[model samples]
Target: MTRIPHEMSGEPNPLRALTLDRLRSRTSMKWRAYPEDVLPLWVAEMDVPLAEPIVRSLTDALELGDTGYPAGTGYAEALAGFAEKRWGWEVAVERTAIVPDVMLGVVEMLKLVTGPGDPVVVNSPVYPPFYMFVEHMDREVVEAPLGADLRIDFDALDETFRRATTGGRRAAFLLCSPHNPTGTVHTADELAAVAALADRHGVRVVADEIHAPVTAGGVDFVPYLRLPGAENGLSLMSASKAWNLAGLKAALAIAGPAAAADLDRMPEEVSHGPSHLGIIAHSAALRYGTDWLDALLAGLDDNRRLLVDLLAEHLPVITHRPGEATYLAWLDCRALGLGDDPADVFLRRGRVALSSGIPFGTGGAGHVRLNLATSPELLTEGVRRMAAALD
Candidate 1:
């Protein structure tokens, strides 16, 4: 049966516009890691409260409160169901294993598949972790700087992989889907190109898909496992970013027969150490989050447009692509004349906290990533501050 797409009902809900209220209503505002007084348009966490359904599920679980080790597909089942429902993809329930977070999955995969000194090709100006994970493992990290449009430099990718393979650095690429900081959603063809390259070089693809579920607009995010050579490589998936449950420390590593045995390389003790509560929260989030996700994605579209309009009217020199994923706006702030790091200037002068661009590595120096998962009032206020600082 063919299903018709559904849209949210009746103008926007006012309840949805309450991040500023939440911020103001807090009586005992401690010094937030995100900083106080200055509105945080920085962290990836949405400023909104948890989806009611998720809150209920977690509340119910806490009421039961076993706080013991989680077992069976009891936890991952929600995640598996979500995959089938949302993406039309089926993951073998048994093959999936829990990890504390997506980065751990990447690190573990890097440790398992490559030697100590192997090279990992990361697309530059990419997620900072893409560089850090390889470096932490003492791996040779090669940079594939992004192109003018901020999409992967397929040409640079070709060169990096070729050199890594030829020089016998034994290359493996960390592929970021619906890439972070820049928010470019890689199309199936784009992902296919990546997979083809990895396959040709016999490089494993440790695809970090933490932000896969929150793509903006007409952009479609193809999971690396859904790409051509996915079975030949490894893919990581998590609900942390999509559901704002990063505190839960729940993520999964999805592998096919090609990379199945690699999980064996991790010590038995650490595999067992992931929190039961985190796993339960993960299950609840994945199972009950569809409606909330739909609402949130809709909210993000509004937020993205607001930023574009505000930037156009107030900060005209700044250029931005409508965030195609992850609700983060990548702004070209170099035109505004603050030398080197501009996010710092936005914070110091604008009184608005935003992600610094340089930490995203190569080709990202002149940009600052704006996080838009907040109430319109705060977002508007943030823009006002930015404009004042610049002017």
Candidate 2:
């Protein structure tokens, strides 16, 4: 494998804030899932400290006893500002509504666009929740597996879109930009092709862009709504993933120009789920957290290169296709000869926890997803444990 030179941003490593001792003391799912001796690298939660701006905002809100119900468009406006500044995308703040989080917002948008039992399209080896929540909503899922190159298979997507919209059913496509597990950032041309295909099939698109801000390694994240033929699509976004504010629970659902009326059809109850404190925290993140985010990105760049070197030296049999974005690394463990579910063996023998790939549906066997958003010391130890497990 060719080595890519590491890029430095000269900022302090924000990830250094969380030492292994500090992380183990927390009670989050990632830390609580395994025994004390096991190293947890399964979940998407970043092992980093909160951005100072977000901390300050939440503290100020609590000091004034301002824990009333969420109101107004603070979250939407903040997102609009961030979008324009970062992606050069013009977001219609007035056309956006606050929802509890990205998943709930996607479900609500799916309800607005497609009926029960209607077909929904997704790329396989996707985020696990894409399968769970869509089934819970009584929707039929059509899989368009990513190509051998680990990017969206346009040919497969075309075929799946046709099957999904068969008989003129009101189908919806759930798009994960800066895709999880693989971390493939979809390009503008690819998004435009998706727009054209959706237009042809008369299907509505709901993009889960929660990972937009964390795109690293010289890749640019293009918002789906910014495409030429994407005026009818809807986007679900939040600062939760990038800013490590998932527990706060705030997200936005923005509509394209032609879909503004459809957003109005969203039930009033949907807007009530977002927390007022969450809005303040998320708003502050978009408004003032860019420097911290940049520093985190620089640190993540270092981690990515470090993992490449570690795998080459310690676990040469396992191949990692470095993703253009996100901290997750998809490991092809087929060569390890550990059978289909290697994560189970690693957990028991290596005392290291990781996400099993089979749960991601078709084409997931013989793979594992490893989270790299930890201190360098912990990351080094985790890889060492996996190597020892093989021995």
Candidate 3:
């Protein structure tokens, strides 16, 4: 692996803010000719390509591709190994199954674990998919919006759980670790609190750790299953985001003995044949993708510092609480009068695309989720456009 030299400049790292020179391809924002057409800072995907080792592994797999039915099996072991190696969580390979994606795992769990008319609770201003999954499943979507700082509202959660119990509502909690939009990584204390609530209500819990790998330092993310009552619950994970393999549909559904039996009872052919390519890509990522993860983390750490410091200086009106995880930056654009449609204004007027806060629920109303996974140049350009738009 080749190491790139970086300078801190006593002032601030340019890599910390955003830069465009780290172009991954001709079509991405980095090298695209008419980048002014759209500076995409909305999607969770990074403009950077997959790490070199991951790339090499997939390239080798394609070379051996016969287009024949892939052995796409052995995925559970791969996930189990990765989990044990990364977080010291002892997940048994037998207790795992492959879902096409993390959100799919949520959908499938809804199908099997939740009943129609059952209430599903989620922290508001969360990943929109959690909202969609419940609504699409015909289950009730219950919102437990975060507190003033946008961290989980423990009191509200307790009250909601009690009311659900009193009102004959069996509710399931979908907890997002290294939470989306806000980027508050739920700590073990938070997880334990939620676990106690779920245990009291007999409501199952599913912890979504899809953005597990990219959490900035100084933040701690507890594996949902590692919580006290988590053994009876479930933990959702994936290598796609960390490995830049989102296009490759492969994720893991991990549970303890009881939950494992439930998953085993699922159709024998749940993950039989998949995008042969996805399987090949997923396998390699789990097996040979760690080193690249280290380098990516370094780059992301720099980008995060840049966003935080720049927000403090030039865009004072736009306050940033800083993220604990993921490449997403949650910005407080409310003070700038950037308009109720701040994200839209940024996209249409400033030529920078970003995730709208409204869809993330009430707490995120005047906020915006900006993608910081792109090059430092692109991030800087987007931030520059944002500063100009606000002033």
In terms of lDDT, the best-performing candidate is 2
Q: List the residue pairs that clash in candidate 1.
A: 216-324
> What is candidate 2's CA lDDT for residue 32?
97
Which model is ahead, 2 or 3, in terms of lDDT? 2
Report the CA-based lDDT of candidate 2 relative to the real structure.
Answer: 0.90
Window of ten residues with lowest summed lDDT in model 3: 1-10
* lDDT accuracy of residue 289 in candidate 1: 64
Return the candidate ranking by TM-score, descending.
Answer: 2, 1, 3
Model 2, span 302-369: residue lDDT tens: 88888999999999989888778888999999999999899998999999999999989787899999
lDDT of 3 at 173: 83
**For residue 292, what is the lDDT in candidate 1?**
70
lDDT of each: 0.76, 0.90, 0.73
Every candidate's CA RMSD: 2.6, 3.1, 4.5
User: So what's the TM-score on candidate 2?
Assistant: 0.97
- What ranges in model 3 sit over 4 Å off? 1-36, 66-73
